[model samples]
Target: MAATGLTPSKAGPSRPSAPREAAPAPPGGAFARALRRNLTAHAFLIGAVLCFAVFSWYPMVREFFLAFQTTENGEVSWVGLDNLATVFNDPAFWQAWRNTLLFTVLALLLGFAVPFLVAIVINEFHHAQGYLRLLVYLPVMLPPVASVLLFQYLYDPGYGLLNELLRLLHLPEQQWLQDPDLSMLSIVVASTWMNMGGATLIYLAALQGIPGELYEAAELDGAGLLRKIWHVTIPQTRLVLSLMLLMQVIATMQVFVEPFLLTGGAGPEGSTTTVVYLIYQYAFNFNDYGAAAALGLLLLVLLAGFSAAYVRLSRAQDE
Candidate 1:
């Protein structure tokens, strides 16, 4: 055979391609990946923490210090327990506490019960629920001062709506805020009107969350409306009720705006004076920040103890 110009090609053993390096894993492995993934969430959380520290925590810390310290002629000095003694010896101290307790009782009677009743009634209706909710929440959206002033108008003895209604009903119109006997009650009524909206809505939400089957079972057991509420509704929403009761007590104990606006903080014969109002008098009217802070510390301790006890009781009940 004639020799060809190209020789037959020989196939050598195949060489494997170099394994690709895994792009060096970016950097700090899993931790870096997680940081990048949650960076936005961490940013928001940090902002919230900073805000709480600046506003809430800082004031509490400052209040604690101010409770034990006094300032005179621009000089600050530690006055261990003197402020507390001053508050204790003040005649208004016991009276203020009494009035505050009275207010809380009155508030619980009206503010606590009324909202739940209102919620129950509103929930019973099959129509106009949205309108009812809006109506209930309308007062909440109004400026609190405006609401208080409106109630003041309604409470006026001479030309107030309440007195006019009394006249129409052939009843003698009595002094509402001016009389010491009726002053606290009047304040409580006004406070309830102004603040019940939020609580009513919360109650409505809780009521709606209840399972309908429970009510059906109650009905099958021949339970009346009251019975159903007692057996089914109350039990189902007990947690919410307890929580709201505690919050109501806390809030009512700290009340200031309504009485301050309605009856000038002390009312007739100091009948409407409250602990918070006394604190205000100490701090602003009397320029005794130390005494005010001391009173505030006492209130804080009381509320803290109450809250702890309440939580313990709730846990016991749950268990």
Candidate 2:
């Protein structure tokens, strides 16, 4: 070679020209890869999306439309706020609201608290825990209708087992489901018994996830049981508690079966007639689909608010 400045010295092979810049990734190929990934993702989601659209979203949209429209003699027509006006004007409307609110409050008091307490107690136990869990969950597996009917029999003022037990204790037999003041309470008690199992189980799982070191630390600091629970347990389980609170509120707000089957939906002067039951009456009893849909929309709004609160609380918890 001509002894040119090209003495094969130091820098090795010039890095092969940087591998030709990867051929610019063939824009179409990159797009195709992304498209394929997105299609696969969407394919996995399509079933659930369709299910939600068909069952939940579609019904919600239909309910919205029905709220503003009327169908009489198979003729559907837009009636603006007439349906809402009818729902607002009905005397039972406010009563239903009041009853629903009361039920939600009572359900929180009983349904929310009892399960948490039961879960705490069960979590503390060292023996027969599984059996107790099964016992607690048994009522949940029962058919709701059967459970309601059973409670109805137990609530019978004249011949019910509950009254008989009261009589045995030398207490006066009182009307349970028949008394307007007690009817809602009675229904709530029945509902709590039937539904508390699921909440209790959830609480149990949450409790199990709580590190024992927290409790030990509290105990080492001379914190008593109640103090440990307040400072440690409650704080640790706040997210679950808040979530359960919202769920119980939403569920009790829509209560229909317990009151309906126990006290015939109206419940001794509509004492137990919830908004859902009112909607049922409007739809099936009066054959007023528009009014029913309007009332249902109102309930849906309320539930949606609760759901939003739940989602916010959940996000906060995750953070």
lDDT of each: 0.94, 0.89
TM-scores, each model vs. reference: 0.92, 0.84
Candidate 1 accuracy as lDDT: 0.94
Look at candidate 1 and tell me the lDDT of residue 181: 99
Clashing pairs in 2: none
Q: After superposition, how far is residue 16 of candidate 1 from its true place, in Å?
A: 12
What range of 10 consecutive residues in model 2 has the weakest lDDT sum?
Answer: 17-26
The candidate scoring highest on lDDT is 1
Steric collisions counted per model: 0, 0
Cα distance off (Å), candidate 1, residue 104: 0.6
TM-score of 1: 0.92
At residue 143, what lDDT does model 1 achieve? Answer: 93
